[model samples]
Target: MSLYNPNRVNPQRPKRIALVIANPATSSSTGWPVGFWWSEVTHPYYVLTEAGYEVTFFSPDGGACVADALSDPNDASGYSRHDLISQGFLHTPELLARIANTTPVQDLVSADYDALLVAGGQAPMFNFANAHALQQQFAAFHAAGKVVAALCHGVALLAFTQTTTGEYLASGKTITGFSNQEEDQADQAAWHYGWLPSGQSIMPWRIETRLQEIGANFVHAGAWQSYAVRDGNLITGQQNFSGEATARLMIEALGR
Candidate 1:
């Protein structure tokens, strides 16, 4: 019997990973520019690429992407000062250029990739909530027996995604997203501290509540900690804090 060679890299047929990001949208509550969380994309992109996987970035509307102000490691607010992973990733000219330019997800065929990772930001609250086309892409990956991962606010899309069988993706599955308590705290602080507008919820709806409405077994690890869960090919991380951990879990599921 031959032992499996985990280190064997198939240079001729390298696996492909699809990184899904949301197109630019304004925060309805604060009118601030919104895009993706820097770490949510950079951290995972770094992990998967370092593991020798050929990764492609995409967005529903296509074109370049932006980072949420709070998620930018170099932002003046210093909100993400602790996010050195993203800071390091940003310093790489090649990777930084990739984020500055992304292909349209609509241009990709589902079968070309072995996995899909949806990145998070304040934008997903608007884009993913009712994105029928995006739901199809997420469901197709699951139906094809591929590893599919989403962390933080990106997981909000799962609340609206349904399998081909017409069941919600998170229905009867264990998952996590940016929690309601965390949202409340962040919103309150941003308001009280003048980081954003005051007196309204940052989002019109909550991720935790939406998942529960669809009967998801939602799990939380409290504020600002790494917590990720894997159920078969489905992987989810709790929040921005769980980005790299979630990517590793997805990589493990991909058997890489």
Candidate 2:
């Protein structure tokens, strides 16, 4: 005889999310310091935590992570002065500590979280595309039928990740990332601010172009628009402004 009662009800476990950020690195293109975008990390974190999801931070090489200079609200460029969310996160001791030292990406397991979000900034344009370990972890999450998400330049990983079957992970998927128009605008801004030599691009590669090259059905909204797309379990954001939209899509995918 079975010991279980048919009338018994069990409580559901809270959803767990793993947020992967890039460690600080100097941009090969601009020689500028780069890391995760402020809004890309804080906005989604704010939304996910508000939904009661448990979120953890991780990095490809582990240890402390930094935010891009322009993404910082206090940056002299004043590019992100209106980002109160990022400003609050930078001031909160507890939150600030979370990014100080992150778990290594190699330590992650597909079974440990319900979803994975790769946050982005200028650093990811250099760091994430060729990180084999990070790519494997991201592929593992997808293979396990979990929600997989990437925002802005973080989506560059999708262009290089392969499925267990050795096929491009983004093949035939409808996705969106930092678009060419946005990249052009960013490049222009960099030159205008003397951050880069005249007529030079700020990033080594363009996320949208890469995804398209990998056979993804790349899509996007207007430049700098808050836009995200969901194609089955894959969720992608257009740029920094789409962080919250991407997180909400992940929640939707997880049925939370």
Q: Every model's Cα RMSD, please?
A: 3.9, 5.4
TM-score of structure candidate 2: 0.93
Backbone clashes, candidate 1: 0
Using lDDT as the measure, which candidate wins? 2
Q: What's the alpha carbon RMSD for model 2?
A: 5.4
Off by over 4 Å in 2: 1-12
Give the range of the ten consecutive residues with the poorest summed lDDT in model 2.
1-10
Q: Encode model 2's per-residue lDDT on 62-156: one tens digit a residue.
A: 89999988899999989899999999998999878889989999998767789999999888878776688999998888888899999999998
Q: Residue 98 of model 1: what lDDT?
A: 76
lDDT value, residue 187 of candidate 1: 87
- Clashes per candidate (backbone, < 3 Å): 0, 0
Q: What C-alpha lDDT values do all the predictions have?
A: 0.84, 0.88
